[model samples]
Target: MEILPRPFDAQPLDGTSTVPKHVQLRESLRSYIVRSGEPGAAIPSERLLGEYFGVARMTVRQAVDCLVAEEVLERVVGLGTFVARAKVDLHMKMTSYTEEMIRRGMVPDARVLSFEQQGASPLVARELQIEIGQPVVRFRRQLLADGEPMSVDENFIPAHRVVGILDDPPPTSLYSVLSEKYGLVMEWGEDTIEATAASPSIARLLNVEMNAPLLKIQRHAYVARAMIDYSVSYYRADRYKLWVPLQRPGVRSPRAYSSKRLG
Candidate 1:
């Protein structure tokens, strides 16, 4: 494996330049990281960086802090900072995780953490449009991409909708099983996404530290008017990002706007 360049080998920041010292250092470090092209590669300590750059340790920290906030580098407790993996951009769409991962040319897999037939909680019942305390099939799964843990998902379905799911082995793709065996195809879904800290159990399953940043998503998948699946998923913020496209309404081209104004 190619090695990371030493801090002294990096170009010294120009004091006469108009750019801030921290910003200059940040760009220099970013260039080195990109050139290395190695995820999880550990750069030099702040002390070494400060000494080599003839700056204070505080200055070195400022540059590192900026990269950390941008997810370009990650600090591990007692382990130092390492280059972060690029985040997966998930387009806001109506598709299963399996389908999305496959389309991205990554191997997708799921491990059933727990499966049970239990009474639906008020939240689950409301989301599924079923009676409170009704029996529901609950499945907790760990979703993986390229053999790495990506998210933890808890799903609930009304027991009457798919009677024999408990008897059959837990499925890697719940949507596939629902569509093929029960004829319940998910036509649409409503998603609520938010930023949250990882709980202890969630942290363990996703292999992240407790209180780490995570993306929490609650979804209601429906087959026409009937709600089929109610699920809550927690994804690692470092590894996943939601992508959305926006268009401004009633916008006209520059030439059209000019012509309209003249007319």
Candidate 2:
């Protein structure tokens, strides 16, 4: 009988006859998903995957458990198990949504809710290198997973740089276009996070209940030293937990951190 292989992202390269063949096979497939950057992407169905790998469904489930324990995949109560998108080390840098998703082992996709050029608001103008009331291109995107709402990102671009804009770029990542088409590279960023009650507008966009606490992260992104973009993000708090692991130089091995509850 065949079984799924292990999933530590470091499966043995040589044959593992001593171990279960299913474990070896699962390790190989798990490696593929990690390297392929589809961490949370929906995997092929168990029946299909079993047939393709010449394994039994039970064996496939065992392999999936290993990935889940590694935090490489997750299973929603109703939704099937998928690659998880949990980041262990939080890096403060200007990174594209797609890159961030891949790091967490989640399959990333984006939908443009709205995109157009508009006059810059006083707040936006001050953040970017532009004058108040200057032309700016604004866009709103509903970032998704296999098909679940995860976050809503809003961006404002200087109008001059946006010679043409697409209401539906239909791309997984926006920075790709900004970098490839406009020669703009995301250099650095500062983010401030807070918990807030969902306003009516936010509730509508995020499909959350009023007064529900939402994770809001405001960012000011720069290209080198110049501030070129600002974004307001509302994330489903239940879906994401931000972690920042600290390491003192010359310190001992890393230890797990547990959030403390205050009375």
Candidate 3:
């Protein structure tokens, strides 16, 4: 059986418009992909698109190049371009990776890469709020979702807080162990997120190309006034995206304002 290419269902390009043809084609392609609602699906070839839109193949290529650069489409050597996988949206919240993965219906796994006690460096000391030379438990793990590599996490905790952590088996969820065994329930947390390129070591652990874009998150988790956990995590930007909610402050409803005026 032969598989025919899906039809593109966007409005025809306006040849007389002042807007650039590539830009118009790019938007039309974007809209068509959204309406199709399929990930990893192959898009029409440049020749076919050029013929349908009455444009040069080079124009079609330029529009496709823009989408490829934005990661909206990916090209394989022997295969044609495809719609990229939808990135997982990470809502800003105080939740463990395991819990978040479960909420997203993915099986979560963690492979412990390194675990040992180490003297706190200046930066580690400042982040964990411990003495410069104080002992700390340092552990690095490669986090996964459905057996696929997702992120690499390196954690630091005051040795005095988790005294026997090094002796025990590495836990899948550190927060769970802390609350169950040590009575250190996390009350609040602060995360600093930034865009960064993956280093060689991190790229190896996360199974991504070196210098690929990553979301670097530095977290400080607290129990009451004491910081209990500090971790630096690098997430693959191709697989994950940050989602933040926004709201305007001090807005009043028109009905409420009218009632207040009458009162």
Candidates 2 and 3, the one with greater TM-score? 3
Q: How close is candidate 2 to the true structure, as a TM-score?
A: 0.58
Question: Candidate 1's residue-wise lDDT over 1-263, tens digit each?
Answer: 33336533567899999998999999988887887637978888898788778789999999999999999998988999999987899676767789989999999999888998999989888888888999999999999999999999999999999998899898877888898999998899999999999999999999989999999999888889888889999999989889986656787667778998999
Comparing 2 with 3 on lDDT, the higher-scoring candidate is 3
| Cand. 1 TM to true fold | 0.78
Ranking of all candidate structures by their TM-score, best first: 1, 3, 2
Q: For residues 212-234, what per-residue lDDT tens digits would candidate 2 score against the true structure?
A: 67788888877788666788888
Cα deviation of 20, candidate 3, in Å: 14
Instruction: State each model's CA lDDT, in order.
Output: 0.88, 0.72, 0.88
Tell me how many clashing residue pairs each candidate has. Answer: 0, 11, 0
